[model samples]
Target: IANDNPYKYQRRLASITSATVAELDVAIPDPGLTTAVAVTVSDPIDVENGAMFSVFQAACDHEFAKLIRHKDLRRYHSWYQMKLREALMADQRDETIQNGYMQDSDEWGLPLGEVEY
Candidate 1:
């Protein structure tokens, strides 16, 4: 089969081994409650971050399918949509640095600014 047919070349790759939960921080400004939780995956799926994201999308799709029966499902879909956007954006920003797609502050054209909580 020629490379032109991508399906013929499809292969299963091992899961990402170099990945680790960098940090987990939580804060509640109102009551001044703060905590740090650790997250880890012992056997993560063998797929790119984009594939993992697609899993999330599939879940959203499944929920949407159920929305046809229950009107309240629409509310869940709206909430999940916002959460999906936030997760995707955060993943994109982090992956840019994690995957070596971007260099340090000096390499980037834009100047770095302090991130506010």
Candidate 2:
């Protein structure tokens, strides 16, 4: 998943400044890598900063609810799904507004319809 969309997750480029060979061994426990001199770590997304995060969280909850057999949980899942959809729509609206403003700006030149042949 990280390979597919690297930009979606915030990546940090870090270098091991000072570490003994034994310390390096303990610090970089992932055996798959040959060296641990430098590493790129993906930080967790700030869910509170964007609507997309809430949408993703709600979707995950909805899917997880399917695995359990509970009446109230199912209801909660439905509510969450609805809220997610609303958030997605709101995000779309906001994007559209921003795009419209960008297009209207003199920096972008005349609007499409106002463009002279």
lDDT of 2 by residue, 1-117 (tens): 446534322324333465532222233344555354433445444465566767777767766766674555756565654555556466665442232223334643533222222
What RMSD value applies to candidate 1?
A: 21.2
Full-model lDDT for every candidate: 0.43, 0.48
TM-score (C-alpha, index-matched) for candidate 2 = 0.36
1-117, model 1: which lDDT tens digit per residue? 234334312223334354542322332234322224322333344545664566476556747657566655545555544444455456665554423223354544232221111
Per-model TM values vs. the true structure:
0.28, 0.36
Q: Who wins the TM-score comparison?
A: 2
User: Which ranges in model 2 have alpha carbons more than 4 Å from their true place?
Assistant: 1-48, 93-117
Supply candidate 1's per-residue lDDT for 26: 36
Among all windows of 10 consecutive residues in model 2, the one with the lowest summed lDDT is 108-117
